[model samples]
Target: MAPLNSHSYHKVLALLAVIVSLVVTTTHASTITRRLETIPYLDYTGIEAAAREAISDTLKRRGVDESDLIARELLGPRQLSVTVPSCKKVSKRKEWRDLRYNEKKDWIRAVKCLQTKGDYGISPISDTLYDAFTQVHQTNWTDFHGNAFFLPWHRWFVWVHAEAMEHECGYSGPHPYWDYTLDYKNPTASPIFSTDPEVGFGTHGNIPLREIGQGGYKVDNGAFANLKVNLPIPHFLTRNFSAWKDWDPERHWGTALGGSFSPEQVKIALKAETFWELEAAIDGLNLTTFNDPPVVPSPDTPAPAGIIPLAGIHNGPHFFNMGDWNGPFWLLGTDWFPAGVVAPNDPMFWPHHTNVDRTFWRWQQRPGKQWEFNGLKGANRTDDPALPTDLLPFYGLGPDVPVALTLKTENWPMCYTY
Candidate 1:
């Protein structure tokens, strides 16, 4: 061996560094692949059975025949006279992982594009077209969640977002959904959090909370890492994938609280008979378990004592993705997704909510359940009927559509399916 010159030594060191980087990256990718392989794909057949059983049991208990219910034509006539788009025209939304690498990149580009456009003039807090949607959601948080408006209102909201991206950013891809159930065993390992700068939503923020004096870890990689926003003050995209044990001590904290949105839990929610029951089951308002005799309470029944309300499918992803601080100050110290009001600040909000809408759509597809929309209405959360005449507020992003028009996904304005 000859004595090495300075230049030769530096070149050797650089080559060694590149080799080490490749090894680490390859190891990480292989670990994720193995973890995902352990989880089984979603069982659609079993899910459908559970949903039907729920509706059947409800009908049996009520002493009402399904035929009579359908004949009564409870789901009212379509409000809009526009021609319903054919199957060929309808866009199909797919799970985030299902999108090809390039498709994912295109969707991400559109999102970034929307963030650069001017605000819709809806709120002073808004600084971009993207911020405008967050503003509206924050302003109408009360009306949107914990009511009959929860499902349909969000259905419309997601549609408006996709439409905005299409018209303004020229995005031609179907809106993607994050089916948390697929990653329910270990959310952190989910491919949706891929660190790939081109396709991933970015990995969990590693920034220490003390440095920022905030709960969330600022996202520092992937497509939205450079993303900025102006709602509740401007900042970079942040996420903290903390478990929910601090928030709900009764439940064991799986990674990012994956158990809350597990396939089994979703199956239980699917068994809900009415819109309200389904909403409660999915949103974690009440009804913890259905195993022992499977008692599902009507909206009128007060939540049973001693049963801790778990953050169901809808909220599980929010809490898990954004994370929360422990103890009495939890509310004061939380991330964007957990904030509930301005959750749209994070691009992950779209796919999470899209999966939510997909779940609602699945429940609606059950026989004789398409027009079976009924739930408690108003800010008081009273037991009023969720009339089709009820209006959904969209601010300036889109038209304020009636609740009726939002029931069927195939209808005009909402010409898409999961």
Candidate 2:
């Protein structure tokens, strides 16, 4: 072994400092929560009167009018400022700098919040497709064209966030979508100012337009060529899930047919890789893995596992790596590269994770495996030297309302392309 020199010792000390910083940063940070918000109604006195009238009218079998419905059911008085935690915005450079060495598991957790996790301060308007922010600029901190990786990743992040929020929170509200092409002028007229440097105001990615030139994908000018290319994925969950099988509950969910799964149901199952090959036909693909750089495992495991898996860093068919789980890793990447464009407003992110949640639902549909807990007798969350057979932390679709399924749940009433 080489002898330790003063310079080497200094470098070691610096690395340790970085590690310490990351831990402190994440520990103190707060997680964004999905708080439910109802759209504003004009007045309460009118609402109650109209509500009484509408109910009486319906009972009388007379056609109810929109004005009456608006005052009664649709419109209500604005209550207190209903706010939920939104994903933390790294509004300044200092926040980003702190993330480098002190964020801990948050490096991954934050990325999830950026897109699909939760909106801290926003009132819950939960529905299957309800996403909080109306503009890409309002969604995250990473520069869109500053790098190519974030475009797809951010789109996916937003996608998963919206779906998960609706499923978990059960806010039956408007799940609005934006038309990326009508972007020259503000399409959504979002409550916030809608100016994003990446794609102007309302422009979302043109996969649909680009593919069929049908709706928003239709471009009139020479601007299409100038669109940023994030390489591997143009948008989120654009990658088929079956490719990563490490912790592929998706496959088990689908295969468990008629309400039950195999020995994989106990939590803490050791996965060989990260994802699965659930939908190779959509993009014409196969089982593949992200060419992840190694990670240092948490102290609980070996240090070799790295803080998190760079699982999203794979052959995304782009100029760089693409990911699902790996998307979270990219959010925390110190590496440098350019990503793609139109990701800021990509609507595909919402639909994609709807499918992802659909997968989670399908998993629940699998009958509780009688054999799932085989070979292991006693185990607790704190059990040391745990086996793969140990169970994991899980709950029903809604924590408020735990749902069981003869089959998994659906993202929308319409998640049946497969």
Candidate 3:
């Protein structure tokens, strides 16, 4: 069994949450807009000294840095406790490609294992993405063994990449975007929230391929928490992709980045830009919920979903039976294309999901994660980076973000250090 995650994060999460309110009561007071328009972009600036300075300066200007405000935000876990399926056992009748948790193992190899494979002939992330998305397996990591035994180890590798983005690249964002589309009533189209617009869209790939995660809205993963989906996720995970493939190209194009997006492609961001231009036309639209009240956004043609079926919440893949933990599981994007996530580069990824994060944060309105709950047996606990017990303040996050409760690849609290 995996060790309990402990209230080790309590002191820290509490420091960040500050408030216990349910509604998004404040965004009505004013519109701050995206900060990126005036912010300068450093060219391919890595997670080194110069990049650090640039991000730090920006956080300071926004007043999100290490002052009392940031300290106050680090309050408590805004997580919930929905039950996910127990997928510990794989069904033998299925092909390896059809395995229930195929995505989980594949994700470990594809995105996470790439670094190891590139450096040590032990790639996992590639095997996963190629196998699931491209439908090819037989990885270089396992050679002829066909063993996907590096689950824990590869999860470690993923944390390293997340850390590089945070520590080296000045990324202070959260992980496993809280999938908002799951809530039928809280569709992102509802104007009831106040998060970065790109939250729901996915990550913006605009960052030159060379500078993928650099210079974006920084998130603090320290407060990160996810519900379990325990199903054969690769199968279930791939379902969403399949649905996109089946969608009428003319319909769900924006939701899936489909065929209509050919010439210029469609893009939206949570940064201040969308508010000033993209959605600016809908500024005066009245909104009652994140659900389908039809707020009538600007530059609006048909509703964003048009025909793509915003009917289903944006949860990962809907199951034959909806599990309580399934929403968070899908939000985080697991075992399949787990090189972490795919939206960071896509414009709509962030705001669409920030609204999702707002939903997760709002879910705290219901009975939430039991502070004393030990979580799943053998589930990963330490993988945040720099680690709290290590006494190292996380390398990349700041302003409103802190490194105190941050965990290491082992999932334990890491203290700040170099």
Per-model tally of clashing residue pairs: 0, 65, 98
lDDT of 1 by residue, 96-194 (tens): 988888899999999888878776466677667788877878764666676678998999888878877887788888789999889888887888888
**Per-residue CA lDDT of candidate 2, range 1-418, in tens?**
1222334333333443343333222211211111133222212223223223332333223222342332222213322343222222211111111223223122222323334434333412322122233222222323221122222223334333434433544432323222221221221232111223222222223333312111232221121222322222232222122222333344331221101111221111122122121111111122232112312221122111211111111111110111221233232332211221222223333432333233333333445321111111111222122111111111111111001100111222112222
Steric clash pairs (candidate 1): none
Residue 73, candidate 3: Cα error in Å is 8.5
TM-score of each: 0.71, 0.24, 0.24
- How high a TM-score does candidate 3 get? 0.24
- Where does candidate 1 stray beyond 4 Å? 1-88, 209-214, 243-245, 248-253, 287-308, 323-340, 378-383
- What is the per-residue lDDT of model 3 for residues 4-101, given as tens digits with 9 covering 90 to 100? 13243334444223321211122212111111111122111121222223223323433333423322232221112312122232211111122223
Predictions in order: lDDT: 0.61, 0.24, 0.23
User: In terms of lDDT, which candidate is strongest?
Assistant: 1
Of models 1 and 2, which has the larger lDDT? 1
Stretches of candidate 2 off by over 4 Å are: 1-344, 368-418
1 against 2, candidate with superior TM-score: 1
Model 1 vs. true fold: TM: 0.71
Whole-structure CA lDDT of model 3: 0.23
